[model samples]
Structures are given as structure tokens and as C-alpha cells.
Target: MATLSILNHDRKIFDKKYIYPVLSRRAGGLSLGINLNTNNACNWQCIYCEIPNLTRGKPESIDTKLLKEELFFWLHEITQNNFLSNHAPPDTLLKDIAFSGNGEPTAAKEFEEVINIVITAINEFKLNNLITIRLITNGSYMSDQSVQNAWSLINQTPKEVWFKIDSVDNDDIKMINQINPSLNATKKNIESCLDVSPTIIQTCVIKINGELPSKKSIDQYISFLKNYEKKLKGIHLYSLARPTEQKITTKIERLTEKELQSVADKISVLNLPISTYI
Candidate 1:
């Protein structure tokens, strides 16, 4: 049996241009992560973000060639060597190649080109059918033409998109995400994502200063889910698993398993699939 821990998702193992390996609980095994935002920047600053020293900005220019090389090298190592069997816990396997890192991946200026490079690498490695591809995003850049084009490419593969929709209330959004994106705009972007590929709503529910989300807030979230329950794949309801880098860390608290189940129960009323990680 593999004896490696899957809970720690540190992004600096290789510290290369784009590729990093993680034992993802959600992915259920080793996941190759692509980090285009090497600058440690993102448009939104979610209070619960685990990235240390995160800044508000788009990624600096991406070196697609370097990214491709790094990806192919890692893929070869993981598959040909005893990478997983030696580094991960027993029974671990390659789960997915995920576009997730310190920031919003779609915010990279060369996102479309980046996707192409990733696809080429995946095909070269001949692991396209052996693994899943995933995009973990804030769903804020779906309106951009380049981002949409990238999504079009992703639609051609066996992939899943984990879109973040933490709260429906703009006030709560500001409090949590530190940005005031209109609720309508966010909904429209999410709908756009659903049009391009399969999407799962990923929500992180946590207590603020020891208080759970208000009933009104939960109702609004449920209502939003009801609107697209038919097209949605499911909901990933999880709590804070890592320490935050934000100054508000003291104000944040992880919800217990019981509390996460409560939230999941409410969303389950929509008759959509729900998964919890606490």
C-alpha cells in the first residue's frame, strides 16, 4: 500500500514554470497541477485563500513552451517511474491533470495557447484516456474571448470544471471574496461555462467569527442552485482545510463535519448530487 499523505496540497514541490503534483482529496489521487499565474496573482482575494502572499493582478506573460516541456517531463516521470507507488499512499492513482494553482488560471493572458500546449502534451504522453482534465476557476473570466476559446478546447476532452460560487449575496461575496461582482454577472458567467463544458459548483462554507451563514444567505444560495439544478453536475461543499494567508485568518473558522452535512442536506433538497469534504 502507498503510504503517502494526500491531504497536503503544497504548490512548490517542483517550483517549475507550470507543473506541480498534488495528492488531491477531490481527485482521489495524484493530480498534475498547471500554474500559469507564477506571479502569485489573482483578480479576487478570497479571505479563505490558502495561497500565501497572493496579490491582486493578472498573471505575467506565460512561457507556453516552457510550460509544455515541464508538463511532458512530469507526466513521463509519474507514469514510467514508481512515482505514485513510491510517493503516494497505497492504491493511489493518477486522478486528473488540473489547471489550478495560486490564482485564477483563466486570468493568464495566453490562456488559450496554454490550453493548446497542455493538450499537445497530454496527447504526446498518451495519457489522455487514462486521466481526467479539470479547470478550477472563479468563473469570472468566462466572458473573455480567449477564455471561452480555451473552454472550447477543453470541451473536446474528458474534463470537468469546478466553478467557484461561494455566495449569492453580494455583501457576503464582498466579505468573503473581497470583490463586488454583481450577482447577475456571475450567474451569467456560470451559465456560459455550463454551455461549454460540464461544471460543478464548488462552494466553501465556513463560520465567520464563529457564526454560520445566515438563513437568508443559505436561502439565496439554494435559490441560485435551483435555477440551474438541471444543468449542474453537482455541488462540492467543503470547509477550510488549510490555514489562510489573509489577515482575516483569525476571523475564519472551519465548519465541523456536522455543519458541512447540514449545508449539504439543504442543497440536497434541490435533488442535485452533493459531495462534502470537511
Candidate 2:
């Protein structure tokens, strides 16, 4: 319930003041966020996405120089102003600069160049020690060679990745992410990521139309995770953290803490490191 409380600034639509504070249960500190979709664009129109007026991804290449400059300026300004609340952890505990917004970041044509630019800026500013790079993706673009090449470049940095694996069953995947993802292909991509860098799977634990996933459906997910438990660093399970834009949106609801814990209980049976936030 506490996660639902929007910061005063966050309540206003089209809020362009980037890099705001969110109580990231998994990141566990002041997360320096990088919202690539300042224009409200995304490749996948996920049902759970809270961003309104979503478009079919960005059409042109992102300006790497401008992106780096903007990110550096914001980070420097925020650090100087201490914009976070007093209750927040010290500066050293401030977490990574996350790549998350309205859409998939790897879709940006200059993804590799942008990542390099960001890394250079971090080092130039002498703030690399406290800063980490985090990539949040839906795994839809992993099979693309250019995307993979960009991911390889990002993997060279001190970073961790969070891949969305909302469901192992194809039907459920279509319903949740609104994209028909190939489970086998996605698993292979995830395994490749684990080979190069620290990677984790993030799943949304929610009830659809006031109905929980059947046992068979849950088992399918658990079985998929079980196969990759050896390579995965951990699992970040969270419920609906914000509202959505879809006809079936209101029918979806956040799972209770108990319900989430129960899912974790089942997941632990596979001998994997799992973290639950509801």
C-alpha cells in the first residue's frame, strides 16, 4: 500500500523532471532512474504499463551525446542538492542508474554508444564507485543481433540486468505483456546474459480478474525457473506497483503479501534465491 503513494511531483502527467525517487523494493535505495521514453514510446504495449498514451517505440536513433549530457547534468545536480529525503540512506548507498521507462531500451539504435557515453561520464565525474548500471528489458529484442551486440557492450560495464519473465506459458505471456514471446528463445537469451553478466528475472505477481493463476500455470513458471536456477542470480517478484492502461486493467489487482509469499514458498522448492515484494 505504501508503494502506491505517489510523490507530489509524480501525480502530474507529462512530468519531465527526470530521475525521481521511487521506493524500489528490489533496488533498496535511492535509484537514479533513466527514463528513455520521455516521449511515451514503447515497442510492446504491455497491459500492465502505467504510462498513458504509449506509442509503438521510437522511430529514430537517440542522440548519445545529448543523452549522456542530460544524465550527467541531472545526476550532478541531484547529488549537489541532496534531493532525496532525510530518511533515505547515505549517498554511498544510492543504487544504480536504471534503464526503465515506457519502453524497451535496447530498441534504441545507438544503444551501445549511449552506454559507452554514460560509462565515460560516470568515470569522468568520479562517481563510478557508487553508481551501477541496470538494464530492465522485456526480453523481446534479445534475439536481435544489434541488440545483443549492444547488450555485450553494456555487459562490459559494472552492471546487473533485470529481464521480465512474467510467465512461462505463451498464452499467459500474451495476456500480461501483450506480446507473444517464445519461451524457449527467451530462456536461451537469459542464459546467454547470465554467461556475460549478473542477471535476474523479474515477475509480476498479480491476480487477473480477481482470479489467481491455476496450479498448472504456476507450475509451468516454476519449472522454467527451476531449469535456470543454477545460472540466475535471483528472482524479483513484485505485484502491481501502479495503475495500468487497458480494457482489462481494473480487473487486475495486486496480490496480497501473503499471496506473494506463497508464490515465493513454491519457488523456493526449486532451490533458487528469490525475493518477493508486494
Candidate 3:
């Protein structure tokens, strides 16, 4: 049977449209996810993205009314009912309500409104101290003021942003994240994220055509992160946990524990803490 476990990675644990739950390795427990990209659209076409039929576009308009309903219903189910006991493993805590779904959540036009709805639900359920409100984002739209304002309202609950920094070199970034980006713009967005909330640099290192990241790429990444050593929370270095849906799947491979640790050890030059997930 498909229940919440390390092996059961299905995103849809229920029939809801917007909200679902998952067992997150980084989160260390169950993460209630809000998937705004019901159309499965995104601004980037990352090579290691797992979303099938990935396209280059923004998300369709969000139905904030329906989203609020789903968020509240799930919060009630987890907090006031026996949903976790039945679906999740024993002793598993509700880790966070993560804005991670099929694509970049901030692409939705109603991004700020959605954050407001989430705060309302978290307040009603009184999950302020027990769980965190997490935004798993690519840091592309972190510079927008409306998005920053939305994040500022959550004073009662603990909050964190998993801002992705897959690569610092533009060439490697275009190949990995599949976007033509300026390093300056990337740094500016990350700085914006730091101003709004606690930020963690989330990186995905993947083997392409049977080779790991080049030393130059890793060096650039480490140097870029050095600038935020004091301002940021920490770093999350992970490889592909699930298979990629992009066309280059034949060349992509997961990192072994030794290889992952080696990269982590090299990144230890910066004094911040680092966590690895496979």
C-alpha cells in the first residue's frame, strides 16, 4: 500500500487539488506541500527537474479561494484529526508547510495572496511553534517587493526559505538550471531573500555525461557562498533523489554517499553548517 514513508514518494497523499503531504529527508519529517503550479508550468527548464512534460512559461492563474479551502482542510486533518497516525509513521512530526510543488511557486500571480492564506490557516491551527512555514524556491523572484511583503507578515510562526543556488558559473547554470542568468542578478535576488527571512542556499550537484561538477564550477560556487557566510542560515547540498524527466536522463546519475561527502568536505572551508540529502 502507498502510505507516507521513505520509499513512498508520491506527492498526492489525498484527493486535494492544491495541498499534499510528503516525507522530506531535509525537513526530517512530514512536510505539508502547497503546489500552486497545477498546470505544471515553470519559468526554468532545469535538466534534472522531475516534472514530466516540463515547459517554459509561468503558472496559470491561481484560484486563491479554492486554495484557502484546501490549506485549511489539510491543516485541520493533520492537527485535529488522526490523519498523521493513519498515514505517516509513528513519531513523525509535522515538520513544515512547504511551498514546493510541480514548479516554481512564486510564478503564480497571486503569490502574496497565497502566503496570506497560509498564515491564516497556520494561525487557526495554532501550529506557530510546532512547525515551520517553508518556501522551497529557486530565488528567481525573491527580489519582488510584493513577495517580500508577503513573507514579512508571518511574525508568529518560524519561517525559512530554501533558495536554490545550483551553480554560480553562468555556463554551468545554463546547462544545469537551463537558464541564461547573470551572476549579479542571482546575487541580488539572494540578498533580497536574506532581507525578508532566514535563508538557506540549496544546491543540486548532478553528474552530466558521467562526470561530476568540474573543480572550477565548485570553486566558483564556494566563493559565491562565502559572501553570505554570515548573513545566511546554512547550506543544503543534494543530488538527484528521484529520476529526472528531462531529455538528458540517460546521462544523469545519482551521487554515492562518498562522492556527496567529498563535496561537502570541500565546502567546509566556509564556517557555516552544511547538510546533505540524496
Best by TM-score: 3
* Predicted candidate 2 versus true structure: per-residue lDDT over 218-244, tens digit per residue: 899888888878878888988877677
Q: Candidate 3 — which residues are off by over 4 angstroms?
A: none
Best model per lDDT: 3
Better of 2 and 3 by lDDT: 3
Model 3 scores a C-alpha lDDT of: 0.87
Residue ranges of candidate 2 with Cα displaced over 4 Å: 1-23, 85-92, 154-157
Ranking by TM-score: 3, 1, 2
Worst 10 residues of 3 by lDDT: 1-10
Better of 1 and 2 by TM-score: 1
TM-score of each: 0.96, 0.86, 0.97
Cα lDDT tens digits, model 3, 1-278, are 24787655556657778888888889999899999888888888888898888888888888889989988887887888988888888988899999997889887888888888988888788888999999999989999887888888888899999999988898888888889979988988999999989999999988888888888988998899999999999999999888888887448888998898899998899989999887
RMSD of each: 2.0, 3.6, 1.3
lDDT by residue (tens digit), candidate 1, 1-278: 23345666666665676898888888888899999888899999999999989999999898887888888888887888787777877778888999997899998878888788878877887777788889999999987767777878864458888999999988899899999869878878988888888899999998998998888999999998899999999999999998788877449899999999988887777878899998
Where's the lowest-lDDT run of ten residues in candidate 1?
Answer: 1-10
Looking at candidate 1, what is the lDDT of residue 227?
Answer: 90
